[model samples]
Target: MSRVTPTTSRSIGQHTHDYAYYRTVLANHALPAAFIDLDHFAMNLERLRQRAGNLPIRLVTKSVRSVEMIRRILAAGSFMQGLLCYSAGEAAWLASQGFDDIVVAYPSVEPTDIRAVATQLRYGRAITLMVDSIEQVMKISRIAQAEDVVIPLAIDLDMSSAFPFIHFGVHRSPIHDETTALILARKIAEQPGVALQGLMGYEGQIAGLMDDVPGEPVKSAVIRHLKKKSIVEVNARRQAVVDALRKDGHTLRFVNGGGTGSFESTRQDRSVTELAAGSGLYAPTLFDHYRAFKVLPAAGFALPVTRVPKAGVVTCSGGGYIASGPMGKNRLPLPWLPAGCRLLANEAAGEVQTPVQHALSTSPATGDPILFRHAKAGELCERFNELLLIQDGQIIDTVRTYRGEGKSFF
Candidate 1:
């Protein structure tokens, strides 16, 4: 694990004042509540739009688990074209909500879920399924045939770099070469009740990897070099794949690529018709290390101090909401507001009680609120039922999370 130093500095007094504001506004609320600063969230959204330029952005639903929040983003502007859902169930639910142009970004193997999507397709809803294997296509085709509808499909291309003993990106999508993509296109063309609609290649190496890690200058340089090489190599390969598919008479509706971290680089590829972004809207802790762009911390949760375990140590009520990824300190939630407070290295964050050590000068009494930023975006919503929407130091509205709405697709 590489050490990450804060790229931007904030004064301790500033954090103190920010926490004071939150405490004052949510004085009546319960502990362990999540909040989103609408002002900061809007700023982050504008940053994403600027980085995307003229290219369309597909909102990633997994990064934002709230339907209300997704609606707010789509209503914000026409730049957001569609949704990249994480599951077939989520896509069907979104379609039922009158959301058109949804693409299930992951392959669905379950016959029930495929039948659900096929039902939506029979109703003339624009929902596309993602596939990287012939087995997946066969499954979808069987469901489509059963439902008596033509299902749309998108080929998920593996954009990871292949070295002698090193793989640079995530292990997703078995289709890596243009020949494989063309073969899949031909397969789809010949298969009954299925049509190729798009091509998706997520360059997670350039999009998710941090290139400006602190205390590891050599590692950072290597990451930057790899990213530069990946940009050129991925662009050439992706273009070739699109070209081959086009020559095979497959008219792709969209070529999706990029993420929040690699927005600028991914959009530069002429083959990618649009980019996908969602985590940037909330600007979680994992997005902090990107050097190309900086986003404001928009979403956070506040836990009430329940005990003064020892001098200079305050224990919060509940805070064991860790983000998903390789186990590391970076995956732990960060103590943000009331700065100078640090998580105890020995215990870290706990499920019931999280003991935080503060500077000797700042003494926080019991019942005071402690603000924290989750390592990821939508994962924070999973911990709380509702997110208290805040703007200008006041709670405006409360929206239900996916869990609160009685829907847990994962």
Candidate 2:
């Protein structure tokens, strides 16, 4: 894929939404259907390209579980080069879809999944497995050797920082320093069926945690400080591991780093060959609080009002699409369109029905469209079969998500 520099530098939330337009355009569509604003998606593509600078991005598949949408985004720009799939099985699935340069971002010890990746490798597909321990390396090597194929592997580097009381990043890989990384690398070299291809360091503290939140000044300020500190520590640890591995004569094909939130800092590391991001494309509510960049809200789902309980209140059928993480109010789906609807505190969003409070000034009759944005990206796709592609106030086309294709890997 050839890189095309986006001639831009700015942040935009993309669309000017109107509830009447959505209700009218999607009059005949289903009650609860997921949709993507094509114009906003295109603008987000430009925004991500600008954030990445010249570095190509390996698209993270968990944030975007739609094969059709992934194809569209990859075809949209050359800056998007490969897939950073979340599972061993997902890597095999993508390889079957003709996607190459894939690195399964998480390690798997499942023999069936490893053999699936080997099958793709036998077909000349590039599917690299992720390993952080000697056991994972041996498991993959045993499966690949049994299949009679030499599989490429990438080491998952733990980029978390240890503070006084708090451990900064997600507990992903056990390989925190150069010593553990070299230990894993030596194990990979000893295996005849698996070759070391690259290293991946995901700074989740800097990348996934929200720093510029509204209303909580003290928390946000503290988060910003920790993020700033974590960036320096992340770069140093990643650099040390890369330098030591290279000095030991290990040829790494790529050093993957960062996510949507850490693009600015992660791009500065010369040791990193590419960045990984996908949630920015969909622009879920979790990504809305970042100070540096604001991507457009590209995807959302709309629910049809079932009944009008009061003048300022209405109930919608089936909305309980909460996000994964620690249980909090932020995990709930955000009431989006009509500009005045609010989720009731007592019930919140429910499995069968959701009661919402609206402004008395605006009346919402029965059968009106009540739109909502998910707390996270791609998880919304798991709820719906297809996403209605919207552009210029019209439903252009309907595309299938990974769930729509009857393929769910997680």
Candidate 3:
């Protein structure tokens, strides 16, 4: 079934989703529950489409772990194509649930994991595995041949640019240059039971890092400058590899790049066929620092205030949904809503209890729901089994997360 887009030119976060707004909407709900504001979610969907321009977007499954949510986004428009699955086993599971055209984002050498994906190929599922090395390609090829099914594969390129004192990107794939990428792609073209389906170059520095952070003009400027330089090198390197492959008479099914943060820049590369984005759908706190586009905090958890520790402090029950990354303050969840509540410095979010400091005027009373946005996206789903779907100021429905569906692949 087709879905409707529910958004307008009006501001999404400035005045729409205030504390009082959700309080009345979720007054009857339980505490420590995750919820999606369908209105804002629709706006984000529109925002993603607009930013992507003509490029198709492959949803990153790691950022959105809910089956229902994924279905809704895919139904949002034809611009949404396929999924960049995090695990091979999970990709096969999604295939079992009737989703196709899945590409596993990471390479797994386990024979059992490869077989799980090969099993899906019998049904003609276009499930492509990611490989960055000849060994990875051979491992998958051996398993694919054993399964008696042809498996497709996408090559992951390391888009990081190295400088004197810094590595300006995340440490991901090891295939860093056109020669290295061609060597691997050539291996795939000659290998048995494995075909070169596409290439994916995740520019983590441009996609994952924030450049316009508040109160850090110098730092932000430095990041922006570094990103500009990295983009030129990244685009050049990616083009070189794509050109080399096509010159070798190999056809590419697709060329995927970037995250939501880098769409504006990534889309400009002629070598790119599509871009990947998912965190923008939910817009966690970590996504707040991007300059190109601002997405609303459409998804968050409401923790019921359990106690008033002081005149200006309220403690909520169970919120420690910290995102997986290098441990630091940025990985901590942001205390949203109530307008003035902030997590304590000494004790930010705790497993059993999270104490928040707030202005007296905006202080939350006991039993009141304290709204908080997670640092990351899909990881939040791992905490809550279900998400309360809110729309038109009412609880429209409740959707099960991947965890709720008895599927935890990580």
Put down candidate 2 lDDT per residue, 153-229, tens digits, no spaces.
Answer: 99999999999999988999999999999988988999889999999999999999888899988999999999899
Q: What ordering of candidates by TM-score runs from best to worst?
A: 3, 2, 1
**Global Cα lDDT for candidate 1:** 0.87
Of 1 and 2, the candidate ahead on TM-score is 2
In what order do the candidates fall by lDDT, top score first? 3, 2, 1
Error of 2 at 378 (Å): 0.7
Instruction: Give the winner by TM-score.
Output: 3
Instruction: Tell me how candidate 2 scores on lDDT.
Output: 0.89
Q: Deviation in angstroms for 381 in model 1?
A: 1.5
TM-score of each: 0.95, 0.96, 0.97
- Candidate 3 C-alpha lDDT tens digits along 131-185: 9999998888888888999899999988999988989998898898878888888
lDDT for residue 228 in candidate 3, whole number 0-100 = 96
Task: Output the TM-score of candidate 3.
Answer: 0.97
Candidate models: Cα lDDT each: 0.87, 0.89, 0.89
The worst-scoring run of ten residues by lDDT in candidate 2 lies at: 1-10
